[model samples]
Target: MSLVSQLKTLATRVGTEIKGLVRPDHPGLARAWVNFGYVGSAIQISSSHNVAGVARLAAGRYRVTFSTPFADTNYCWLAFARSNTNSNTQRMAIIRATTDTKTSAYVEVICATATGSLADTTEFNLMVFR
Candidate 1:
């Protein structure tokens, strides 16, 4: 093949590899993610990818359902939260593994106040990886 043809073939292979790396089902990409918060006592999802829905079970507890289920219950997850209250308290977001499944997971947001109470946060973000 001519030099130009060889270069063209190499470029096409590179482009195909890059597209595979960024596919939605790529292993390096998050399987599901959601950004949610409360709006006047109701849970509101601000943005999401592969997340079907979010439900508030209690004060700081929530259930996040995925649009596509994982192969098993071996996925990893991350959570972050920030309170809306004007206080200097620290906050923590935790995933409840006991309630985790191929289709959904649970999260709880807690505040580091005197009571170490579970509280609704102004913003909550969750991500899942398989």
Candidate 2:
């Protein structure tokens, strides 16, 4: 084969190898992240687990329903975002309930202070990762 032809073939193989090395989302690899939470008014989901129900367990405590249980009680990590981002000093905690079958979240300072509190918010979203 011509010297030029051999060089071209070698270049093509190197380029292909480089492309494969740089592609992080290659089909053979599993995703590095997964969605496991929801935005609610009527309630919507973003996880592999299915939503079975939702309810207010108490004054400032809430529950989210998952049809199937999580692999481990401590595996879930959760966060929240309120629709009103104008201002706030309040905070929320979305965590796995002590009871495995029951999922709950705690919101502090709910309707406590008019400013920077849950009293001024309309909607919220939850984000979970395992």
Candidate 3:
């Protein structure tokens, strides 16, 4: 190939790599749930308490597989809802996993610090991706 053509090809290859690194692939959607009395309030990441759930998929009655990547140790990089449809009461936060495998996460719901509305119950659906 000529010099100009070679340069163009190199540029194209670099562009492709950059795009792949930056743009993540959407692995469709998946779901998880919390029980009625689960205290999913806030990202409780501490030496004493680390509140997080592993994203997983079940394979019949044999093996358990995690669709998303998760660490054995927990961190405080998740979000949760007070209820099913209370967007106003939902707590949003930026979660950063320890790895970049783009799989799995541990999320927590923000807690309410009050007398009447401190404790709550709810279930939530998580958008799973890789």
Instruction: Return the number of clashes found in candidate 3.
Output: 8
Name the TM-score of candidate 1: 0.71
Please give, for residues 18-125, the per-residue lDDT of candidate 2 as tens digits: 887967545443222222223343333344334454444443344555555445544344445443445645545434344434323221112223343323223434
Alpha-carbon RMSD, candidate 3: 13.3
- Go through the candidates in order and give each one's C-alpha lDDT: 0.72, 0.42, 0.34
TM-score, cand. 3:
0.24
Q: Mind giving the per-residue lDDT tens digits that candidate 3 earns over 83-108?
A: 43445444222233243233244433
The better-scoring model by TM-score among 2 and 3 is 2
TM-score result, candidate 2: 0.38
Clashes of 1: 0
Quantify how close model 2 is to the true structure by its C-alpha RMSD in Å: 8.7
Model 1 lDDT per residue over 74-102, tens place? 77878888767666665567545455333
Candidate 2, poorest ten consecutive residues by summed lDDT: 105-114
All candidates' TM-scores?
A: 0.71, 0.38, 0.24
Cα shift from native, residue 13, model 3 (Å): 37
